[model samples]
Each structure stands twice: as C-alpha cells, then as structure tokens.
Target: MSEIPGLRSAAGEQQGRQIPPASLARLTIYLRALNSLLAEGIERVSSDELAEAAGVNSPMLRKDLSYLGSYGTRGVGYDVQYLNSQISTALGLSQDWRVAIVGAGNLGRALAGYSGFQSRGFEVVALFDADQLIVGTEVGWLRVSPVQDLATVLGRTRANMAVLAVPAGVAQSLCDELVDAGITSILSFAPVVLQIPDHVQLRKVDMATELQILAYHAQRAQDPDLESGPRARAAQ
Candidate 1:
C-alpha cells in the first residue's frame, strides 16, 4: 500500500516501467470476486468490501486498481460489471486464445478434457505426444497426434500457445519444438527450467513443488517449532 513514487514515470524516463507482480496477480482475484458479485446481482462494490472478498487489503487493492486507470468513485466505490470488463481486457481475456497440449499422457489428457479452459477464453485445439501407442488415440473430442506433427498442428490450428505435459527430461526438447513451431506462450507441467526466447512467455506448474510446499505445511503442523534443531528433526 505504500506509494509507488516512480509508477507514473514521464515518457522519456530512463528507468524501466515496472508493475509489481502482486498487483498483476491480484487482477485474477478481482475478476473472480467481480464474477461472484455479478452472479449475486450486485452492481457496485467498495474497496474495503472487494478487498475482503478477494483476501487482500483495501489500500493494496486500490493501488493495484489505480494502474488500470480511475474507475472507482469518490464514495460509491467501483461498478462491478465495468471493473470486471476492465480487468479482463487488461489480461487479454476478452478474445478467445487457441491452445495446444503436447504430451498426451494422463496429465495432458486431463488438461485436454478440462472444461475450465473454455470458460477462461482458452480453447484446446490439439493434443500431441511422441508415443506411437497414444498417438492417433482420441482424448475427449480431440485426437492425439504424433509429436513430429507439432509444426503441422500449430500451423493448421493456428495455436499461439501450447501446454507442455511431457516428462522432465523431454520437457526442454518439447519446449524447443514448440518455440520452433512459432508458439509464443508455453504452460509447462514438467519440473525442469526451460531456455526460451525473450519473446516467449513460459509458465511452469510443478506438481512436485506443490507437494513439497504441502509437505512443509504438514511438517510445521506436526511441530510448530520445526524451525529449530530437535523439533525440526521430530517434525520430519
């Protein structure tokens, strides 16, 4: 909530424009809260109430919202519908984005079958895998194609984004292939760090990392003083 003094820099400012990651992430929370408000037929919301619903502080929420321009009223707060639209527009969710899934394993198959993608303006157009046994197989309404056919599928489907669900060892190769195939965005599930171009956007979802985080919480729950010596060993 502290003032971001250099936020609104001059046109010729030497410093790079930096928007806080927390502020950017809060847009998603705002969208969800606004959606809930819309479902409940609520038209307007105060900063304090919206922040509480989004599990964030009011000043922080106000500062984040300010980056999108002045949409809040002096006393009445913000118009729920308008604010929702603004956030969606800022996140580039106003239009449908085509997505392809590489590696048609259980995780990939599940992603291809997920209904949430459609609701979020992401359409799964193709599924790819190197395994011949799984290739040509049907997953939901889409057919799994050979990994060699990735370029062809990308060209045919015009997908700008791809989801990599391959194993850790093969994830890098798959990512390279996707980049070569003109994919600008990648959502990888494997537990490997990828080398990608500056123009490419890579998002990783490591289940192992999530499990480790959960394990940490579980360990702490078993022994609150786990940070110290004997307690930590006991917690483990």
Candidate 2:
C-alpha cells in the first residue's frame, strides 16, 4: 500500500514513519475547528488560538498539525483556508467515499437520512436488510436491498465502506459478509466487539457505554463522597 501523501512535509518527507492514532484524532478535531473558523470568516489564526478553539493545548495542536506537514508560518500563523485544505487532503476528504448501511433498523434509518454525511463526502449509495419485509422498502432516495445481494449491490454501487447498525448477535456474521463483499471500512454501532480481518478497518461506537460514562461523572458530581465509599474501592 502507498503511504498517505499528506502525512509528510514537502521537505521533511517522512513516508516510512508511523503516525500515532492520538495525533490522527487530533488532526480531525483541528480540521473541524478550521471548518468553523472558515465559516465565521476568520482568516489567519495563531496556534494558541486554534488550540483554544479545538479545546486542546497549543503544543499538542502544533504537534498534530506538524504530522500533516502543515507548520504555520512563523509569527504570521496559519492561513485558515490553506490549513483547512491541507487537513482535508491529509484526512482523505478530498475524495468522495460511497457508503452502504447494513441493517434497515432504526439506527440504520437515522444514519441513512442524516444530511451531514453528504456534506462531508460520505454518499450513502445502498441500504441492506436481512429481513425480507424491508428489502424492497425505501429509506430515502435509495431503496433497501436484501443482505444476500451485498456483494452485487456493493460492486454495482461502488461502495467502499459500510455502517453496521444491526443487533450484536448478527453484527459479526454481517461483518463477515461485508468483508467478503469487498467492503473494507466499517463503522459499527453494535455494542459488541466484532472480529474483523487485519486488512479491514473497523470502528465501533457504543452509545450505551458513552451514556454510562456520563452517568458515572454525574454520579460523582452529585455525591463527592461516592468516590471514597467502600463499594467504589472494592469494585476498583
């Protein structure tokens, strides 16, 4: 596989170097901050200001932006539009990615109708369901197809990624089918650990886990003494 073009400076050329995942995540956050700044007609921004906008420290933001080969001009700071373009290209947002949603349930339906995906270069080309009842039904502009037609639909639509929103029990099996169908990237909403091939990129979003985490913080805020309780120590 070829190295990502934007991962290196034009002069530095660190093609063989590995980028830390944390840095990559921060780059996306930086990209979002740039987008908001651009929309507000903000032109040039210093590293400290950008870091404040992104809710991260200035040094870390600089470090993350450095990995994208974009070091702001000394004294003048970064050009907002140019920095945004650099980050976009670095994150592969310069190209449109056709996506497929597996499972025609509630979560799948919501994701399918989300307009934000289209603006960000994610085009949902196909929706699939194992249940025959929803196979021919419409989810937006596209009609739902049978899961059995995954490979054919993927090839026909040229979809490179898929979103798995099915039940935990069927997520792995459906994931296997997606991989077999040549869909390499997947964003899973199933609250379970899915086994995927090393070649395929898989990301999981557990809503329940996030809510539970929030609940824990809320509990701590409500009762400061809870952290000192015997039950908390025993559990820990």
Best by lDDT: 2
TM-score of each: 0.83, 0.85
Candidate 2 — which residues are off by over 4 angstroms? 1-12, 226-236
The CA lDDT at 170 in model 1 is 92
For model 1, give the 10-residue run with minimal summed lDDT: 1-10
Candidate with top TM-score is 2
Question: Alpha-carbon error at 43 in model 1, in Å?
Answer: 1.6
What TM value does model 2 have? 0.85
lDDT of each: 0.83, 0.85
lDDT of 2 by residue, 1-236 (tens): 11223434543444345668988878887888888899999888999999999988889888888776644677678888778877776677888899999989999999999998986789999999999889999988989999988899999999999999899999999999999988889999998999998999999999999889878877877886636645442110
Per-residue lDDT tens digits for candidate 1, residues 89-118, read: 767787779999998989999999998787
